[model samples]
Target: MTFLHTIGAIFIFAPFLAFIMFVLLSRKKLKRRSIGFSADLTTFLLFISVPVSVESLWGLEISFAVAVTAILIAIFLLVIEWKKSKEIEVLKYIRKTWRLYFLLLSVSYILIWATGLALTVISFA
Candidate 1:
């Protein structure tokens, strides 16, 4: 059986780990950075929190919770950005910076998964 801590670690650590992996693999050609402490982070935090929130609120499984949370987060981010930003330059910046933002997010997710898997294996051993 999977432990809550394993899942939580993945939720928290995936982004940073992914960034480090990318940096190493890219041989310093690519630099890791974050857009800011804003909607993107909110989405990621919400995504990670979904499972726990759903289990607490509606008795949903982790996978289902994550799916719903992701959908909600995407909608929210899109709406907020569309409503708040009107300048073309800001939009352009967002487009250009999205790569790093997404890369960090992917890194974190992978780290979490790998940690969980390692924990599972170690527990079984």
Candidate 2:
């Protein structure tokens, strides 16, 4: 139980741990299986990590952040789609939104990680 919790926390905090694990296990087989699986897995983990990272960095509740992030992405995609074709291309927009969110969350995760490290150093100093 405790071990499982630790593993869960590690995955939540690292974001790409599971993705890396998969890639390592897949090795050459991963090429034949396709790179998309790794990307999709990282993206899914980012969905959880963004809010967790925010909360850890700020010591504030970010439970609603995930929902808000998803909603905002949807709205932004809708706007882009409207500009692109002025119609609901559900499949296209959804895929675009997921990719965009991955980039956005990846940036957030890096920033948060840096901030945390800086804060730790500052506290020591």
Candidate 3:
């Protein structure tokens, strides 16, 4: 269904899409630390998106419970990070590799978005 495809696309690309938005806005100040944070955040969100999207399509499922558990775990991790935010290590190669990371992340998400759109269009056709 079109709705299903749209939801799938969103779940797949939402985190990456948001990351690109943030990265573009922070281009000048995007340090190695920020890129590291973005990478971790992107992985975490994608992990969550899987079960959440499954739940959305199936009404209710065990995956929904699992997704909630994962969310709680993510929250716990975030809380820990917040307390020790100043202790996080800075990436040495950030200045040199930040552009590459940004480019890859952007390309990956764009591809994901395009795939979703294609799925939606195909489902309707």
| Per-prediction backbone clash count | 6, 0, 0
Scanning candidate 1 in windows of ten residues, the lowest lDDT window is 30-39
TM-score for each candidate, following the candidate numbering: 0.36, 0.80, 0.37
User: Local distance difference test, per candidate?
Assistant: 0.51, 0.79, 0.55
Off by over 4 Å in 3: 1-13, 25-27, 57-119
> Where does candidate 3 have its weakest 10-residue lDDT segment?
92-101
RMSD of each candidate?
A: 10.3, 2.4, 10.1
Instruction: Please name the candidate that would achieve the greatest lDDT relative to the true structure.
Output: 2
Cα distance off (Å), candidate 1, residue 98: 7.4
Model 2 CA deviation exceeding 4 Å by range: 26-34, 86-88
Q: What is the C-alpha lDDT profile of model 2 across 5-47, one tens digit per residue? A: 9998898899777778867767677675534566566788888
Query: lDDT tens digits, residues 28-100, model 3?
Result: 6866566555655565455555455445544445555655654565456556655867463335323223444
| Model 1 lDDT, full chain set | 0.51
User: Who is ahead in TM-score, 1 or 3?
Assistant: 3
Please, what are the lDDT tens digits per residue for candidate 1 over residues 1-125? 37887855664444454334444555545334332333344345545543444454446577664566445655665666667776435665554344444554455455555666776799899
